[model samples]
Target: MTKFRFYFPDNKDFVDPNFDGRSNNRTKYHRQYDDDHYPHQILAELPYDGMLVSLAGVGTMQKRGKYYDQELTEDFYFSGARKFLRLDSSEYERIRLMGDCGAFDYHNEYEPPFTVDELIEFYDRGGFDYGISLDHIVFPYFKDEEAKDVAAEKCDLHELIAESERRIDITLKNAKEFYVKSQNYQFEAYGVAHGYDKNSFIRSVKELQEIGYRRITIGGMIKSKTDELLELLECLNRIRESDTQFHLLGICRFENIPAYINAGVTSADSTSPLMQGLKAGKYYSVNPNSIRFSESLMIRVRQYDHDNVQKHIDKYRDELRQYISELQDNNGFDIDLSSAALSVNECVKRLEIDCLKKLQQYDETGLDLDVTLKALIAYERVTNENYLPSKSTESKQTQLKRNEDKYHQFLLAREWRQCTCGICKGGLMNIIFRSNQSNRRRGIHNLAIVTKHKNNVLKSINPAAK
Candidate 1:
């Protein structure tokens, strides 16, 4: 069986996690939670085969040379808990090597591809079961962001694969070659996506099958348009019909882990604790059996709203309550509500509108294309920079006005249309009045073009306690 693995960069002392790559404000920036940890020792502690030891990409200034950080030395590996027990020299001889798909120079925008031979030498000398890492295999070209140029310059398999395949093939070939030569070894490759679509991912998986590659890992905190992570997993299930082991990246929340795995992901990874330590000057201190929120009061704040926005909040809360109710009623705890609730297409619609409202509130000019695009291209890359048909070097001020106008026009066109929020069906659109019911802001929920009659019926049936 292909074992599920975790990367552990050693933080033996749990020393101060600060580094110079960030501002000094102590803000938990994304990188703080996303990168940097010595993982060798930690990975050894996991009971599952899914864990792989990787050098934490923090504190290392130079990108080249045989040694990455202090973590790569054989001494460190030998001293690791697994070194004496699970990882013997003979076991190492019979081991397979696996690498994260995104760990190479080309993926990081450095010059000169790290050839497969160099990688094999490193893994062989390092004495690992598998050499695995991520590579930019499939580049999705949305509007203007063409993968052809990037592929031509960085990917050697450009002619052999599509935008998505280019990224997967590099890792696949590298792993396969290692397995063939070692005779005593086996290898697997993973594909990582910070931002790519369900369709593109499906296509990439198909191409992987065509080339006989079987393992895939998906995700990053990159803006994903799909509202539910479960939806993404379901898409993976569709791809895995032909037998592929799916891995979820950076999954720290315990409640969410089973959902992904149940949806067919063979294993998962979590850097949240390390990320938290780097971010807030402390670790997240995760409990694998519990669910947590980023802030304790977010759900409370949503629950207490005095305006129509509370309707949306209430819907989410009710959904949560319903899941719990189902768990109790069925006496079974393995329900996948994410896949059971809605389709990916429905999720994209709700996310696009919600993100658009957020962009309007956050964007200074009320038309920040980058921010909007970031949200817009959450799951998929809108690579076509020139795809903006209207604005050709338009001023920011003009762009804001144009975008606002477009937004209002969309409202007018979709008027009387009942738009159900993707997160919850109970939140259909209603006519929002400019009443200062609470400290509420005018949001997409406020302007939702939903089935007001159905909302009225729900309001009548489930009125808030006065």
Candidate 2:
């Protein structure tokens, strides 16, 4: 069996649960927040075959204030990703590190931002197992941000085709040089295939094959529809050598994993279940035993109204304090302090922690779902970034009624309760909270699920492996 692999793209998504509802606050930061806290640390613990780190992503860490605050850009260049991730540790012996140009980050540049030699230096220094050549993306097919998915098909076909070929030409030129220049490097060299459509995709893959790349990754599919992706993969399979391996870049779907593996993909990377965490008011519920989200099982928050959430917290201050007091068991929980004595920010942080505490207790003993939901809903209210504005036309009562219906479905399913992933450590309910902690945990858990599905498919195809 050609063992299929799945690599997660590192988004530097580690979260500090104690984060004071502020973005990038230094006092709240921890290098190993996921490691130390429950619902497990994603990077060290995620059961993935490999991880893909983009040079473009690292380039941004050049600024002193970001998460990788301990290292400067030159520091990273010297130490490389392997040292950064500490993949050298005995615990991560099986996990491979892959490198990419992270073209999308520098898409606006007329040419790829980094040199071939620079990428080689990076991947080699990091002890990467695989690295891709820098390739400029075909821009026209990429949907413009404001237009959503409508922009891709709406682009002039002639322009799309012309621009795709132009970019493919540049990609091939880089690939030939990258492969030749990488002769002394230990990592396997893979080139990117950029196609605006089916034939062009095949042509690019064929060109990559001719360049002596045994492994090729198909890029520019983030905007493609499911059927379109399958179609492209099917065509590539027809022309390629039987042993040639392919990867799907930036694919963010669980459903796509097994289907694409069947269509000849060996590995892929994406920002799913993790990104699901950052999205407001949305939650993923596994489809019974399956990895993909079950719409019927998913939960919806009533609102991500940051302004209203703050207003409600202020309006119900006395009631919230009373509720906390009653739950304190006479010892007086730290949250029992008068609101007047605490800063508003401190109060919100306490309530958030209290909710996580309560949720953990509920997860252990199956506490009343209604009460747990109230606490979670409270935290969700305060922590929400208001990603989605309330529809001006909808009445508050209507949103509440719909959310109630969604909550009813969520309780009936409660599949998240069955998950044994580390993210549930904060409490099974913690995985469902709309806060940064829950969302990122859900995403990491989602990636693990995808890898599990990939292995399952691989085993099904080769039954003896079981």
Candidate 3:
């Protein structure tokens, strides 16, 4: 039986809530951060044993020179015993450039791309358990002739192919060079296999094997659909050797994991759960049987509508006044009527009213209005600020017909409340009610749930392992 591992990609923006330069310095943020923060030290604290961080990400961070610009020297990125696979910077840059040229939208900028030697130095200094040879691969979107033609005017296909071949040669040469340079390093270097078609993929794998790579990573499949990926997996399966282990780069779909594993994939990586959690409507929960469930939160009345803003404010104000009067009548607390008309249309008013209601519900005394207001303001600023709900013009019947399945799933998950994950432990309402940290926490919880499911499956298959 084969041992399968899931690798989490290090995307600082998604995981770290306090990633800004003020709270935490950008230079050492990746390598070090406060462990007490829920999502900041996720990589270190999470059960995941493997990580897949890009050289381009580190290079970009290095180029910015946030904290350790002058101190980077030549090997700052890889100075610790972190178990990660160092991906080549070229493919990352190509994706950035392609996005710049209108291939697709990519978030990060491509800056100060690292050379092969720099990568090697980074690897040597950073005590990684495993490293992958750098290979430049083409994006799957370029397979379409029309798309290729459009991209060719700006990014030439011929040039990309040549560059890819050159990178492969460099990767192979560097793998051997590094092996000879640091024979006692104890780090395993795997070759990267990249190609567009079946024959090309076979040739790439065969060449990597010939160059003394017992382990290979299959690239150029990130954008591929499930069917397309399966076809590629089938092609690889046909030529796979018994002793060689293949890692599927960026293949993180839970439903497709079993298929990939059955097709001979030993390991894979993805940030889907984390990404999903950041998006609107999507929420993740774990089922009783350990299967992960995804359901969209029901869209409620839009709070941002120009017409309803005043209406909501008026209603909340009425509710607040009524509650306060009830409290006064029952001699529950002292009434401060001076702050009653404190700009009802303002967000601060809503936050204060909400917090006060919560306090009243809990029957708490010594209400520090200032502290509660400040805390609520901070949370609202991150979670609810600038949030605009989309106004759909479709009929209610039509909308229900379209979202029948989604509604069914939402109802099922809402009723059961069996999901015991950290995020869902607070109850489905915490995640269903959209808030910045809650959404991200839900994603992290989903990742944990899916990881457990994967481990369980692997354990069942390989029951002999302790």
Candidate 4:
């Protein structure tokens, strides 16, 4: 099952109830401060599969003491964040840290120096799991590469891989040693970021794999590279064939999971606690069913003349809550007595909302080619996962053909070609790209045609040449 993790800021200060959900430095208040029990109270209330807290000290360290600079603002927090951070202190939650390893590089750069033993002591004091966010690793600093790279050398593939290895080795060593004692610590390494090259990205993953790091994410801040993303999918598929756990990271959108899931990705991490958090009606959060209704709503709303976006946002939020309420009833939760209904219906609804938001954002912001491909994968996955309601209007044959055509279109777009023969020398010659059964086609052997000269070469010539 895919897991959703809400990032809880670890700040201990009491937040004003009317603080307005905005961060002073660069952080945007996603969840209001609930100063009493940390974010655990919120985490325990929700029916999420996993919990992901950004490594401690990130907010204070990354943009600490910096004034509201628009460029730096956009670099860390997305647009509209400055306003969002001004939330009441009462609405904010204090995040608890279980382990001592700074989970992010940005914080590490500014974090006060602490020995490994101190980190162990923190965990021994009762920590759950510790992980490093790869946001700072794969993404260029401050979301700007050229500026950050002026001082640092462009990440050479070989050199970066070597450096990453030492880091992973240390992490793995710590995790192993820590787990042995505590028996409750989980280890994770984050790598999904947008815009990294195929070679460097894969090399980093390979290094992580060598050091026993699992749970790879695909995109971060909607900036994953298309070629590298597909290659990552391929790598994940191969890993799945060999029986390994794979995870897609920062997957707030619904349409991004199917490729990874079909390729055997075991889980996904997202933060979409409420529909209104990531822009009210837009289902950019992890809700599947919510997005379906939201998409329909957006289409209907677009038909009318609406001036302000807030009206649309409010409308979507209302509709989403209604569906969620209906799902609670369906789940047999006590609608009359129970204050909140958390069930699979709400989960699906939330995912739908996320999908709708993602699609709309892509359309509005000029979709990335890699994201476009990921969206297609999500489409395929949703259909495959039985999330999209089945239609009785279409005959089975029609449905089969449509599905076949979808795969063909994807393959064509990706320029995927199989070998013509065992030797793999010739291009796909007379290839049978599709078959009548379940979209499986015989490649290589099925497509090969023996010419006279090729036959002679196969019989007598060197096997390598053949």
Candidate 5:
């Protein structure tokens, strides 16, 4: 049995909630901020082994005055990957560092801007245990039958084939040089493979083996459908050499894990599980993991995403709360300030705060589900936040009712308390609260689940390793 490796791509995702969900200068890039806890540091303190970090930071883009800057925000010019991530200490021995060229960053280009020597220099500076050679992207089969978007309009068969073959030639040529020159470098090297079709893909892999490259990564398959990818893997498995290893780039389908392993994947990495938790309405829930596991389901919680309108709501709620406190000083805590002299906006702001208090209270005691959610529905209608519900001319009453139904299902189950991970140990409310800090914590929790299942599956395959 081949010992499969599971690598997680680090994105510096988790943040300090106190800094409005932003990392400060102290703990922004480094890992040694022990005093404040930085929410106790999940990727470092947790059992997040087999970590993969990119040289240019994958999907790195920032907007300037008129145009966007493709440069990664981290000043890696002075510090290496480990130092920048604050993983230089011996405590993070579990994290097996892998450096990636982030070829997807320049996928649209005719050729990679950075050379093989430049990547090798980056790998040496990163102090990585494993590194992938640079390769240009080869798009999956795209013709008149497939594309739904404007890519269909610009589909030129002659230009597409010509461009794809150009990428393949350069990638293979560069891989040969990279693997041969990699003898001087410290990190173990893997040549990247790119091709448009299955026959072309197999031919590229064969050339890689002839170049004395034992490890080969199949690139440009991110857009390929599951069945198409499996067919390619099946073909590759027939010609797979015992000594050589294979890895799939940017594709991890947790729904069909056994199929991929059976098709022969020694290692793979993906950010989907953790990122799903980060996105609104994309909540991932899993069955209890034993030696044998079941399928995981992503429950789409239908509710208004208040992140964008939260600042405005917060401002109104704060002002109203202060005024109410002053009113309470004159009358009493039990006094009916509901009938006090106030505008419609002030009344709505007060309602929003009241609804929020009930929601928080429900999180603690798990009581008042109906009344609290009803109050929330009323407040949601009053505020009319920037979500689709507000934009559409649909029945507000019907939308609010659907929101209540979803919240009822979500809250009644209490999925947050299911984990024994370090993040879940804090409090249930913190994990499920409608805030970025909560969303990130929830995502990291899902990653823990994913990590466990991957290890267990591999353990089942190779029992003697442990």
Candidate 6:
């Protein structure tokens, strides 16, 4: 049976939960979290075995150009309600600080970013377990050519073909150099293969194998369709030696992992799960049978409108006050009208500020407050069911659809408490709602879950080996 591993890409501050600032800050200005309270500390302790660090991401984080001076590293500090010194590359390069690199960042560049010697030194210093040789790429379906055309003049077919051949040659040369130099290092090196088509990909793989690489990584598939990527994997599987392993680069969707594994992919890497939690409208949920997506309150904040956010705040506040009065007068409830009104007003004020901030940050121009108000009202209804006034049939139905997945997930977390993961300990609602800490912690939790799932799949497929 083929063994499979999952590698996570380090996309600057996205995958690094220890990133500093107001949680929503996702630019070059962000700094690393302090050592004592590194958000990824829990993740580091998890049994995740592989990491893929992008050289570009590292360069960006270090605020350097395409390449940085390896010897010069610095720590940055942020001053706010929470202030701490950031980790420099020197600090992050330690094995104890970061785990074994299952794969190193190599891309399709005109020139190799690091020479074989420099890469070897880096791998040795970082205590990496594996390294992928640098390679140039020719994107699938002539997308690269199209992109180039958009930037300048259109390339003729002959020119495109020549470019592809040149990329392959450079890749092969880099692989040969790496293999020759890697003899001095303890870490294993995997040659990278990039091509424009299935046959070319197989040819690249064969050439790498001939160059003494038993393991190879497939590149240039990031832009390929799922079917195209699968076809390439199948072709590689057919031609590859029995002992040879293949790593699929940049294809990390959880749903696709099983398919790739089935197609004979030995390992794969992606930053999708973490990225989704941080940037997308939904959070990834662990379900072996199917991929589940739960609504993220962070997305709600991002989608909030500034034009009429005030209207929503006012509407919700009035509704909440009316509901509280109804409960006290009609239901003869012992609700303190003044305190309830004050609480409602305070929440509305906070909601308005949150909405405005999101609007300004995202640069959205619209005036739809209904969805925002509905979400808040739904939460209020859920939390204070008995005291809240019953919704009208139309409003109730609308809210039911909106709240179904969130409510279900919340109940699941509450009842089973099945996930004792670090993030869950903070409360499931925190993971579900909008906040820097909550979103990042949820992302970490998602990583743990997905990694475990991938490992389990591997075990089930290769039960006798372990």
The lDDT leader among the candidates is: 2
lDDT of 2 by residue, 1-466 (tens): 6477777777675555543322223333465523333222333345578888887777633333223444545566677766566565677778888989889887777787677877787787767889999899874433223433455467665565676688889998999999898878899998999876666778888888888998999898887777767877877889988778899888846666666766778888877555655564345444435545454323433223356666765766565555444444443333454645775556666766666666556556765766666665555444443311232234654665566577666664665666655554444444554455545666666655556666765666678896
Better of 1 and 5 by lDDT: 5
Compute the lDDT of residue 119 as modeled in candidate 1: 48
Let me know the TM-score candidate 1 reaches against the reference structure.
0.41
- Candidate 5's C-alpha lDDT? 0.64
**Where in model 6 is the C-alpha error above 4 Å?**
12-31, 36-40, 43-47, 59-109, 142-158, 256-259, 289-347, 350-416, 463-466
**Which lDDT tens digits does candidate 6 get at residues 142-242?**
33445445634545756776787887898799889989988787778889888876768889989988989987888778877777677778888888887
Please list the C-alpha lDDT of all candidates, in the order they appear.
0.37, 0.65, 0.50, 0.33, 0.64, 0.55
Clashing pairs in 6: none
TM-score, cand. 2: 0.75
Tens digits of per-residue lDDT for model 1, 203-321: 65565556555566664422333334667667668767556677665453433444555566655555444433233222111122234312101001111223444443344444434
TM-score of 5: 0.77
State how far residue 408 of model 3 sits from its true place (Å): 9.1
In candidate 3, list every pair of residues with a backbone clash.
78-126
- The TM-score values for the models, in the order shown, are 0.41, 0.75, 0.62, 0.35, 0.77, 0.64
Q: Against the true structure, what is every candidate's RMSD?
A: 21.2, 7.1, 10.5, 22.5, 6.9, 10.3
Better of 1 and 3 by TM-score: 3
Query: How far off is residue 130 in model 1, in Å?
Result: 3.6
Candidate 1 global CA lDDT score: 0.37
> Which residue pairs in model 5 clash with each other?
31-86
Q: What is candidate 2's CA lDDT for residue 219?
A: 92
Q: Rank order by lDDT, top first? A: 2, 5, 6, 3, 1, 4
- Weakest ten-residue segment in model 2 by summed lDDT: 384-393
